[model samples]
Target: MRHLSTVDLKVEQVSGVTIVHFPQEVDAVNAAAIRERVLRLLNNGVTEMLLDLTGTRFLDSAGVHIIVRAHGRSTALRVPLSAAIPEEGTVRRVFELTGLSRLVPTTIGLPRSAGPAASRSCSTARARGRGRKPRR
Candidate 1:
């Protein structure tokens, strides 16, 4: 596990999946830091990733950019990626408006099914960017 200095970003490992717990707010001030860490994880060969945004209450264009870039990098690296955002909220609305929910699986909670065995399946599907569109 790793924590970004002076930031609430927390990285955890579970069954080989790296889960990133985002801070309460993601904006220009810390988006770069978050992006750097996420990209580093991917470059280091992390097989799978989960962005935990359940605690995130505020987001801006910079934050959205980070998500988009991370998704692109993960796809290019063939690394599965997912996110946890509340079913209804400002953050979720942003994802919907930006169409990110279509490209990534945004769930209400950390997927309990992310055990080692399940992560294999998730990698095949998410890494390829194949999933149902989020409902409005």
Candidate 2:
């Protein structure tokens, strides 16, 4: 039941999965902080992660870099990482253009089961997009 809030992110845990809510803008100014927080979570042995970016309106290269790094680390650690990107917006577009969505598991919005059932729901959603598309 760990909860942590920083100037650029809000972190919460749901059924052993870590969910990170991004701010409206994730640029060079706050990207490092966000990256560090994510690193700490991974180092803490987070089994799964959801990068909730539905509220993000702007994300520069540095912000994208943070996600990329996270994906790499998570993959190495065997921790599943997913993202909640809006249907359409700067954030989504950035992910698409960068081909990041293809690399990570992603859903249109925050997973419906952010509660006790999140573990099952997240896995199901990822399986749904496994072969056909990039859920990230």
Each model's lDDT: 0.77, 0.78
* The 10-residue segment with the lowest total lDDT in model 2: 116-125
Tens digits of per-residue lDDT, candidate 2, 14-91, equal: 888899998899887788788889988998899899998888999999989999999999999999998888766788
Cα TM-score of candidate 1: 0.78
TM-score of each: 0.78, 0.79
The alpha-carbon root-mean-square deviation between model 1 and the true structure, to one decimal in Å, is 6.6
Model 2: C-alpha RMSD to truth?
A: 6.9
Best model per lDDT: 2
Write one digit per residue (lDDT tens) for candidate 1, span 48-103. 99998877899899999989999999999999998887544678778777777777
- Cα lDDT for residue 91, model 2? 85
